[model samples]
Target: MNASPIFHRLALLAPLLCLGFVSISCTGYQLQTGRPQALTHVKKISVPLFENKTLVPRGEILATNSVVDAITNDGTYHIATLHEADAVLEGTMETITYSQVRSTRLDTLRSEEMENTVTLHWQLLDASTRKILSTGKATGSSRFAIDANQQTARQNALPDALQRAATQVVGRLTDDF
Candidate 1:
């Protein structure tokens, strides 16, 4: 069988197209697979029970557990004991505040919707020296409807706020941003 002109052109172009694709595939692209430089020394972290300065009961437990879960999910640092850790992350549930988001149409003085916020003061310290490596404050909030039981509504939304704050703390620790 005799090859047509179109077939000859296609045969020549295939190798050139492959070469072009191969050449551009690695244009300044690199696999980045490590922690940030600031946290290079801290591979394992220990989280103690946080202190609760607010009136909310069990707020400290929720905050501490949230941070631990975030760190575990992040996979950047191992959750180790105090003796095995390179750094200790200690935090305090400073304030649990609430504000009215939406007022009732009939009664402007009452709240139809409200927001619950949790503020955390945290520090990353060296396990051995106790020297402060990083310290900051993070706040997380969630909006909830004012049901018949305001206390119950507020309590139900506390974990979401705590989780958001914890994620922020872990992100700052791992990414340094």
Candidate 2:
């Protein structure tokens, strides 16, 4: 019946609605905020055979393969051969130093714990422009109880640690760019 109550309610809500709209509109234009822009220009990515400077064999290959898998699975970029892509990803393993030592019961012949650590350095670059997009190092470590032999424990833990580092490095390179 009376328009007074309706008008009062509308007046109270109008400013709040307007503010909400303005905030949404501002966020819509925020740079690099939404789904990644389609990698139109660099449709194809070339991952050269990574060089394994570590004492471990195929360390670089494993890291490179993981990166390629991430890019391919991302569905945004196509994997191209070394000479056929718009951008090339090259990486060199600067270091891979790890120690496997007893962590528990130092005085006792039978130790209760063991630890393993894997450290790696990596870089990502755009081949066409020769631009270094990102470069950093990542490390992964794991510990487990050992009954008798340390070598077996070290070997088993090393791969998993390396895998962790590889995934972290690749995810950083792919998602941030």
Residue 54 of model 2, lDDT score? 74
**lDDT computed for candidate 2:** 0.66
Error of 2 at 161 (Å): 1.5
Clash number for each model: 0, 0
lDDT of 2 at 141: 69
Model 1, residue 106: what's the lDDT? 91
Deviation (Å) of 118 in candidate 2 = 2.5
Report the Cα lDDT for residue 28, model 1.
Answer: 96
* Tens-digit lDDT track of model 1 for 1-177: 898999999999999999999989989987654566666889999999999999888889999999999999999899999999999999999998999999988998899999988999999999999999999898899999998999999999999999999988988887776
How much is 54 displaced in model 1, in angstroms? 0.6
- Encode model 2's per-residue lDDT on 74-119: one tens digit a residue: 6556788767777676766556555445645456655566565666
Model 2: worst 10 consecutive residues (lDDT sum) = 32-41
Candidate 1's TM-score reads 0.86
- Which candidate comes out best when scored by lDDT? 1
